[model samples]
Target: MHFVTGGSFHGKAKWVQEHYSASRVAEGWFNGYEDASWETRDFTTSLVVLEGLEQLVKKVVEENVIGGRAALRGKLKLWLDWEASEPDRRLVLIGTDIGKGIVPLEKENRLWRDVTGWFYQDVVMAAERADVIWYGLPQALK
Candidate 1:
């Protein structure tokens, strides 16, 4: 899995395409996916692009799941594991760095920032190649 993240509008998708040239790319957020059924789907030899991953986490945290950090981390791990199960498929997770800059006043927003940043760190550490994009340029961090 290749994890790529940056602030919004930083051209992460462009970088992914230019580098991987993956034929099948599927973007999430409007993905209509749920944990119960996600593992059954096929992702073999494909490139799955999940844009705005923070939003997905936020949604999950709000709706069904509970137990805070550990639960959230485990849920995310399951999702990522499903993506990685098909070894030939490359999962390109495009997320925004919401933990930077001024923090938000709203409690949920603050939590989102914290959790997203935390999860990103964990994900990056596990990824074979991790990148951060700035001004449409990619910096390979791992």
Candidate 2:
């Protein structure tokens, strides 16, 4: 598993595309911005790019489906298991960094930010590789 994170519109998607498009088509691209349903996705491709994970975190947190950090980790375990199921398969996760800048005034926004931060930490910990994109340049974090 690979994890990439950066501010919104910082070219994380473009970098991932260039890095993996040689072996994978656009069909493997999954945008959580459009649909945040992780359970409904079918992992049949060798390369799977899952972007907009912050949105998915927000959705799950807002829905109150996550009872605690353990619950969230369970969700991540599913994806990790999928990646480990195949030696040739690669799972690239892209999340926008939303914890920077001014803190949210609303409680809901604050909760989302906190949950997303925790989720990102979990991903980075489990990821075999991790990077942060800045101005379209990727800097390895792990």
Q: Which regions of candidate 2 deviate over 4 angstroms?
A: 22-25, 65-68
Q: For every model shown, what is its TM-score relative to the native structure?
A: 0.76, 0.92
**Per-model lDDT:** 0.67, 0.86
TM-score of 1: 0.76
Candidate 2 per-residue lDDT, tens place, 1-142, comes to 9999999999998899888763223777788888888545778888888889898888878778457456678878988898889889898999999999999999989989998899899999999999999999999999
Off by over 4 Å in 1: 22-45
- Cα error, residue 55 of model 1, in Å, equals 1.1
What C-alpha root-mean-square deviation, in Å, does candidate 1 show against the real structure? Answer: 4.0
**Could you tell me which 10 consecutive residues in candidate 2 have the lowest summed lDDT?**
20-29
Error of 1 at 28 (Å): 9.1
37-112, model 1: which lDDT tens digit per residue? 3323554445666656676667655654455557656755765787667766666776777777998998877877
lDDT measured at residue 54 in model 2 versus the true structure, 0 to 100: 90
